[model samples]
Target: MKRVVFAVPGSLDTPTGGYAYDRRIMAELRQLGWDVECLDIGDGFPLPDEATRSAARSLLLEVPDGLPIVVDGLALGVLPDVAAEVASRHPLLGLVHHPLALEWGLSAERTDALHRSEQAALALVREVVVTSPTTAKLVASDYGVSADHITVARPGSDPAPRSRGSRSEVPHLLSVGTVVPRKGFDVLVAALATLAALPWQLTIAGDLTRDPNEAAKLDASISQHKLAGRVATPGAVSSERLAVLYDSADLFVLASRYEGYGMAYAEALSHGLPVIGTTAGAIPDTVPQEAGLLVAPGDVAELAEALRRVIADAELRRRLSEGALASARTLPTWQQSGAIFAAALEKLA
Candidate 1:
């Protein structure tokens, strides 16, 4: 049997797109007849203490020599020394969602450190797997990885029924993502505050616990704008509930600062919902011009203007909805993603 170790940080059940991609791809690889063993390297990764670092090193050392092992970028990016030590003994494949240096809210020094570390770690890997072409290009250009050594296996979206839309007198906007600075819920709230005169309601569904300070700031902003009655934050939700939200939402919005792959945007398209997002990262690639409007990240005025146009013009919304459905049809399925991912791994074997 073709066996490999998939090293990931923390639990596989985390409610995040990256984790979801890892879990789904691992399962699919197993179905393809590869013996994929998962190795959880604990939490506080990319900023691990000495003890955590030692543990990760020990775990990697335990793997049999010459076996291929896939390491999640979140953990591997910060462990250049450990990765360097392991590279000679095993075939290391890096599965990077995005570079850790690109994460939002980092000090200049920290960003530089992560960038250097990630570049060093990636240099030692035999090949790198990215979720989007944007990231593949990034790894080649910024991290010094050769283009030929990179593989892009985009995330897959499930087929969903088109949204019936909200019956409320006002339009219902839905945003899904963990409440982190990167997700830019703060920017979304600031934009929505400007559109208070319009008849629209918003519900943000995400894990508030992921970043409590950011969540608290959002709550304060909602209250300060006197939009307490117009917005809802339901925290983390189940897959079934998220599907229901998509079905009922008039529009799907997320003003994320960056995205390695905008899974939520694709999910919105699957439900035939118009998107209101930024032109950050891979968003423009995922959301077509006809399907929605994209403004520069952190541009509150532009976001508000886009929101106003969509709120007042039902015809424009209809056109975008049709466009969304068209775009969704072009998205790759999970099964297809698995095949691509399997092919990438098989090459190493």
Candidate 2:
């Protein structure tokens, strides 16, 4: 049987979109009879301390030399030395959801370090797989990795029921992602604050535990805007609960500063909800113009304007909803993406 080791940082069961992609892709590989070893290399990735790095290095070293190893970019980017050592014996591959250096709120030094290490790691890998086309371009150009070395396997979107919407005159706005600075939750909340005169209830649902200070600041912003009643931060929700949120919501919004491939936006499109997001990274690629309105990242005023128009105009919402469904139909299934991912690995052997 074909064999490979898939090393991911943290719990494979994490609720974030990146983890979800990892989970589905692995399942697809297994179904194809690949001997997939999903290894948890521990946490604090991309910025792991010495102890964490040592533990991760030891675990990776234990993998058989003949089997290919696909390391998630989260930890791999920062572990260039370990990757080089491992690549000397194994056919090493890198799965880059997005370049780690592109993440927001990093110090200049940290960004530079990540860039250097990732460049070094990518150079050693047999192949690099990215989650989005935009990422493919960036990695190739900025990181000096060849386009031929990179494969773009976009995230799959499952079929979802069209959003019935909040029957109430007041619209329900939904934004989902881990509450981190990179997500631009602060920008989203600021935009909503400006639209307080409008009748809207917002639910920013996703894991808040990744960055407690960011979550607390988000809470503080809601309170300062006198929007505690209208806005709900229910943290991470189960799949069932997120589905319900998508179904019952009138609109979806997330002013992310950057996305390797905005899976949340793709999920919103699949749900047939109008989107309000920034034109950052691969967001414009994920949420097409007909399906959503895009604003510049971190521009609260622009996002607020987009929000004001979509929430107030039902006809616009209907048009966008139709577009979202149209866009959703074109999205690949998990099985298809998985096949592509599996095929890439099959060729690696």
Candidate 3:
């Protein structure tokens, strides 16, 4: 039996796309009869430090030499010591949701630093697994990594839309993600402003990361737009509440300037909710022509128009909802993801 270790930034308690990916992958691999282990390198934001690097190295040393190890690109990018240690022994595999350097909003200094760090980390990895082709291309063009070395293995969703709710009377608009600038909540707000005459309510759900400044900005935006009654930002909801939100919502909007792979989009579609997203990053892969609407990034007018179309036309919403749900049911599970991953690992073995 082969032993596989997945290195991540933190525990499953604090959810992030990278964390979800690792958790699902480990679960699926375990089901497949591989001896699976997850090594949490510590959490918070930014990146790991020297002590975390030491912890990763300690974990690496514990794994037998030549073992297949998958490193979370989130924490690994910033840890050159960890990269150096992994390079000396195991065949390193990188699972990058998206490169930190390519995140939508970052200062020039931080972007450059992340770029340097990611380049160093990529140098040690034998294979790079990303959630989308956009990231695969970014890794090749920005980091000079070979495209052939990178594989795109996207995430799948299991949606549960509510059947009892009256969709016509209460048009629900849902947006999910950590309240961050890159996710484009500001753009969503701007779009909502355009639809002020409409009776629809918008719900924003996700952990508001402990950054007070960003939180203040989001609060101020909601106030400035005077969206108090119509907009809801219930920070950090449970999975059950999220499913309820998806079930009740008429449409899901992701105004992100960029995404590695829009898992929420898939989740919304799975719940039979039509999606509205920008034509940026991997979102195009999930939002089929019949399932959702795509607008140019930051185009509030376009989003508002799309919102109006979906809200006013019952037939259009019903058609797209059916299409989206069908698409979701057809999506691969994490077990399937593991099987494909195992095939990739076989070549290296």
Top-TM-score structure, candidate number: 2
TM-scores of the candidates in the order shown: 0.98, 0.99, 0.92
Residues 1-349, model 2: lDDT tens digits: 8888999999999888889999999998899888899989998887799999999989999998778999999998999999988888888889999899999999999899889999998999988999989999999999998897888899998888888998999999999999999999899888888887899999999999998999899999999989999999999999999999998999999999999998999999999999999989999888889999999999989999999999899999999999999999999999899888987786676
C-alpha RMSD for every candidate: 1.0, 0.8, 2.1
Give the lDDT ranking, best first: 1, 2, 3
lDDT of 1 by residue, 53-125 (tens): 9999999989989889999999999998999999989989999998999999999999999999999999999
Candidate 1 minimal-lDDT segment of 10 residues: 340-349
Instruction: Sort the predicted structures by TM-score, highest score first.
Output: 2, 1, 3
Number of the candidate with higher TM-score, 1 or 2: 2
Instruction: Give the whole-model CA lDDT for all candidates, comma-separated.
Output: 0.92, 0.91, 0.78
Candidate 1 is scored at a TM of 0.98
Clashes (candidate 2): 0
Error of 1 at 47 (Å): 1.8
| Cα displacement (Å) at residue 213, model 1 | 1.4
User: Candidate 1: where is the Cα deviation over 4 Å?
Assistant: none
